[model samples]
Target: MPFINTSSPHQQNQSSVPDLMRKVLLALIPGALACLYYFGFGVLVNIVIASATALASETIMLNLRHYPVRRYLTDYSALVTAILLALALPATVPWWLTVIATSFAIVIAKQLYGGLGYNPFNPAMIGYVVALIAFPQQMTQWPVPQPGGALGLLDVLLLQLTGTLSDPAILDAVTSATPMDQIKTGIGLNRTIGEISTGALFGTVAGRGWELVNLLFLLGGLWLLWKKVINWQIPVAVLSALFFWSWMFNLYDGDLYSSPFFHLFSGGTMLCAFFIATDPVTASTTHWGRLIYGMGIGILTFIIRNWGGYPDGIAFAVILMNMAVPTIDYYTQPRVFGHQDED
Candidate 1:
């Protein structure tokens, strides 16, 4: 009789929540590799430490809430949250930064609203925004992608753990500038795009290495689209809207507003467009809603980059739009079939 109950109409969807989350984690690999190549081994170290910390915090919180610790921890939400946060953060950020941010992300931003699906904010972005707000200097210390061995896992771990780095000199200089920072500062000082964009900025980007890294993420994003892991509506919409606005502004005054490519490859444009905005729980499920949600993010991203205090707008924009998901879904809901005039 219990087996017969399996045929009941109240069965859950075939695709498990855990399975979807796993696929998202897998999609991050190519982009992560690109980031590692550009930034250094520090990113890899960040991933491992952050993920481990996320798991531990998630376990502890689950226990505190009297939830099934083993089952939920194994679901790997914490690991994904850690990975995304690690990706967003600067390589040379201190170890405690990761620990505190990861804990807050998993506990308050995620579980406090009644665990994963119930949370309104994206866990990774929540943590990232908090870190950025609390420690602006550390969060902004992005690294340049050098030709040779810029970083190593063990070296970073040593620095993180003991504060007695193997080569303290090299470790101290590991930080580099992000493309957005370059453009923002350049434009501020009345330096033409050609002046400040010298080092990594020479090769068709504000930061040379960063352009390629964003390119790799774009490729991976397309791959996700092809695999149907994410819908194209959001990414394409976000990118296009951003480009259109940036282009218009640049045309109006190239001195103040940056070029369209700067808006595209700079900061977390590609990654956020594809990954964060596609979160099913936080994003609208309806097709039209997806397009509108994406447009909102893109508009906010451009506005913030141009005028907001932060150089990057992805985290703030995502969290803000997350609050509107319910309204986006409600109006975008498709009418029930064969209900015409039947109500």
Candidate 2:
């Protein structure tokens, strides 16, 4: 009998990279639809623009690097990055900014470090951070949520393309501070959380229209969990840590600090917990490392939201944690089975 050479861990599952990517894309649909319902057509426009830009950039980079373009394109990783970046962006952002962010995400954050699994940081987040830093005015201007979906498709296109509508009042009517920004600003002005919560933007739990969007995202996250696309450690740890910190602060002074529920359901909290922090390539591999990594993100996010310049800090927290993954994994790696330690 002849022995065959092969890789270790001969056992395999039915899931391929494309399969996993497909499931993630599927999981995002409910949240994406909710965004469209609440924020109007600009969200859809951003998705289309980002997706196109990402695909084109990926293809060009793969060709320049002499890699097999078709093989990589079929994996749908670029699409996922594109969609995530698009969703993070303000729905009212100009079309050119969307293109630039998506392109930079695919080309620089992703391919420059050697593409896909090889990249250390989350590509979507890198793009978002870059955009947020580069264009603070555009990035922070989140559209006021219109539950009736009042903004017509053409009006959104006109605004995105020209940076204005025929009537400037329309643009002014739709644009406003996000719930997170509102709370931050209100707090800065010495207004109590109670007074801020009475604003029209505040829903029963979190931001108006935003809480439901987050719930839909939570629904999608649960689906991802059920499908086993992601491990439970990171999400549970992130949410738990965030909740604990927020609860503690709120307990000390309800007038000064927002409640845990507000933090949990507001502005990318659920999305970051389930989708962003759980990026397998960037996150820690060890079981304990995952928990520690998640806790770091949660705590940092809270700190940044409260004390840092940015209203929401998920992006910064994630990137900072990504830089620590190597050290985390090394320290938290499980001991080898049956291996004895020297005294």
Candidate 3:
């Protein structure tokens, strides 16, 4: 009998990819729950629709490509991507919109570039950008949380199945514009930051109950860091840069800018910093590279939010930096064990 060689020439490093992916899915639980709490049944419906559509599309695409659908589909990547896309979108986005975005994420952004690790851009972010561009009205509209009246899981499923959230007229009336939209409207009206904060436009820590949701995501993110599934460099650096820059700008001109808290807790900052920006494949691999990558995201995010057309820039910033990951990694490679400097 031939002897088996279990050991590598040198000790090898390995971790279960599926387990790590599962942890990431687990890490998202708090954020998802918080989103559901604040946004209501619509969020629940979005996940069901998006996940189902993503998996179904994955199976179809796998068949078309002549690949083993079970191997890739069971890896749980599609589910993770689905959850990310669903979380990023407005909870009340139509079922068809979720379907389109999820399909694009798995098909065009992921598989077309070659599956999973081969894709250059974050697949979910690609989907989100496409949806935002194609249906700005659908993506930007947000619903006010009903507090005590959130739907149970079964009810949410029914809502997704039936394509209605109770009475249609009431749904249309209550689905208000997001804080960003409100701010834009205020700016168009020549209203100052102070003027928008009063009355119905209360920040609610960036919108009613959104800050609380953000805090939960932040908490879960720290847990991920502690678990060693993610590094702190990117998230800390990104958030710090964003918060500091916003504070400085707001202090310089109170009337012109939203406050630091608003910047910290609003839009997709928490989601991007914790879940999206920390994506291992697209983000920097080296420690220094990660800092550079994250700070770049933070700066670009702030710049875009202030000067670019979109009120939230986290997704766009992430996609832009994903494009530069190779360069960032190339330049910032760590010194090897026995390498002499070019000097």
Candidate 4:
């Protein structure tokens, strides 16, 4: 008698790689739109350039590796990586920087490690870290929030392409250090939180335009949770850990430590907590492992942001936690059914 071949997950939903990727892409829209509104057309241009480069690089790598290029391309994983990396980048970065980062993410970070499921790190974070380390100046050149006048599409294109503008004063007027940068510098100069918070760059909760961006991203992340695309353990753990640390330190010295609200609402905290750190392939798999992994990321991000060289530490924090997922899962795995401990 012939027997049926069945896998452990005999009951399966309709979820496929493409479906998951599509949902994630949809979830990113609100945050992306907010970035565009605050940062200008450069945000859109970065996405376009990064997406095109990701597709082209993915295709080339697939063809060279003798894989079925068309089938894999349909998954939209590369596009997600490209868009995530682009969003993490400064909107006004040179166009070639976007191209380089996206290509490296697809070719080295994703494909070089045997593609999607086999990779151990988040490709987008890897790409962003690479670009940041290689070109610190360009990576930190964030545009001022709600500039007096937004750069036109042509102006953005010209500036990104040639690293120059017809009017030098416009470039100077539009660019400034991000809120995270300002806070770090201010604290280093012995300025109190009250003093720094008075700057025009600081908004109600965080930065002028960044607070709303983070809130929108938080909404998108909530949507992803509602759609069942991501688990709750990672995000909840990350935020809880971050809040606990920031709140504790703020109590110690309000002048030296920023409030939890600022930490939560500034920079890419929401983005990392939800989307980047929750990457299924690179993140911890076991239930308890995810919590530990997320807590590790949250703690590391706080440490790096306060004392390390970078203004925003999400990229570094994610990458560091990604390296420990294997160990976390090994120790935190649930006991198998009918298994007993040897006492």
Q: Which stretches of candidate 1 lie over 4 Å from their true place?
A: 1-13, 152-155, 162-173, 338-343
TM per prediction: 0.89, 0.96, 0.90, 0.96
Error of 4 at 85 (Å): 0.4
What would the per-residue lDDT of candidate 3 be over residues 137-205, giving only the tens digit for each residue?
878777765563345555445445666655556556556777766776787788998888773636565
lDDT against true structure, model 4? 0.92
Q: What ranges in model 4 sit over 4 Å off?
A: 1-10, 147-149
Each model's C-alpha lDDT?
0.82, 0.91, 0.83, 0.92
Model 2, position 168: C-alpha lDDT score: 80
User: Per-residue alpha-carbon lDDT of model 2 for 232-297, expressed as tens digits?
Assistant: 999998999999999999999999888999999988888898889988789998999999999999
Better by TM-score, candidate 4 or 1: 4
Residue lDDT tens for model 4, 1-343: 9999887888878789999999999999999989998998889989999999999999999999999999999999999999999999998999999998899899999999999899998999999999999999999989887843268787888899998887878987888889889888999899999899999888998898899889999999999999999999999998989889999999999998999999999999999999999899999999999999999999999999898999999999999999998899889989888999757
Please give the RMSD to the true structure for each candidate, in Å.
3.5, 2.1, 3.2, 2.3
True lDDT of residue 215, candidate 2: 93
What is model 4's C-alpha RMSD? Answer: 2.3
| Collision count of model 4 | 0
